[model samples]
Target: MGLSSRSAVAIHALTMLARWSDKSLTSAEIADSLASNPVLVRRILGSLRDADLVRSTEGRGGGWLLARAAREITLHDAYTAVEAGPVLSRHPHPPSDACEVGRNMQALLEAEFQDAERAMEERLSQTTIADLVQQVLTIERKIGRSAR
Candidate 1:
């Protein structure tokens, strides 16, 4: 199980907001940079807004902005905001009652999947939007595209 593009887009939007620091970004602007539809940006923004990771404005000079400092936001926070289901999917097998292995396998699989998800969440919780922004800036600098 890999994360969806929505995860990448959410991370990018947050990183951009962090880099801008004081400026709000319109969905159009974020869509342009992310090479995705503005509607898609808005959808992701809606989830972020619900999570209190971002705040939206209306009318002129309006857009979206990070609701808090980047350092306070973890990747797991973002993931949790958008995650609709389990991190890993399990196969649904209706085992025969007479089969000993099949009858017990489902429980075992669920336990293993839960453990994996916990481990993944733990790792994600350790990284913040600030960390992602720093890595992105480093790459931009290495490629001579630093904002300076």
Candidate 2:
């Protein structure tokens, strides 16, 4: 199943915050970098805040920051924070009970999907926000821009 754009955006925002650990980043600034709307950025940040992935501040010199160390945050955690439902949704149609394949396919599909999701989670758990941030920084350096 494909992940929603919100998940991607939230992960990017978190990675950006991790890279800029010394300073907070406003939604406007993040939007500029992501080429997205500031309001959307705020909405994504709001969700992250609720998940305790990020913390926000008001007033001047205020914005958002990672709630904890980047190394402690996994991609699966970010996905779980933004995803609305199961990673892979199945069709609701009841297979023809008369057929053995149809009668058993649902269970098979469910098992397969669960296994796939577990594998994905395992892979994601191995990589943290800190890893993503470092990759981004490396790309920025290769392009001759400071990874702010």
Candidate 3:
């Protein structure tokens, strides 16, 4: 919705690993949960691996595992691990200096965009992968009760 789905994929992969922290998970398994393909999952996971958020093994029984505890990894950690560039976005080309509005817009937009991005980053830092796992289980419990 914001930019590329890299952050989302990375976060999803993280939570899945945390949920099954007792064992490692294959890219195929994580991809299945995402309704995505294994190659894309591996690509995003590779970013996480480079970021030191996850680790993997090779050969038989090889898979992915969290490098750190879920509680120790914030949404911001996952976000920055995979996604790059500014959050809000900027124009590809600079505005014209001759036009009054165009001349003023870029500077104003820059400040606004930076502020928005900082706010988003701060909010993301407040939550962790562990928090999401608990929330998912809590919601599932409630839904199960209602279905009875």
Candidate 2 ranges beyond 4 A from true positions? none
**Tens-digit lDDT track for model 3 on 1-148?**
2498899999899999998999899999999999999999999999999999999998899999999999999999999998888877687798899999999999999999889999999999999999998887788798884211
Off by over 4 Å in 3: 145-148
Error of 3 at 44 (Å): 0.4
Error of 1 at 86 (Å): 0.7
- Best candidate according to lDDT: 3
Candidate 1 local lDDT, residue 82:
77
TM-score for every candidate vs. truth? Answer: 0.91, 0.90, 0.94
The Cα error of candidate 1 at residue 131, in Å, is 0.6
- lDDT per residue for candidate 2 within 1-148, as digits (tens), equals 4557988898889988998989999999999889999999999999899999999988989999999999999988887888786678786688899999999999999999989989988998899999998888788889999844
What TM-score quantifies how close candidate 2 is to the native fold?
0.90
lDDT of 1 by residue, 1-148 (tens): 5457777788888888888878788999889989889999999999999999999889998999999999999988988887778877776557776889888887898999899999988998999999998998889989989663
* Model 3 accuracy (lDDT, Cα): 0.91
Worst 10 residues of 3 by lDDT: 139-148
Ordering by lDDT: 3, 2, 1
What's model 3's lDDT at 67? 97
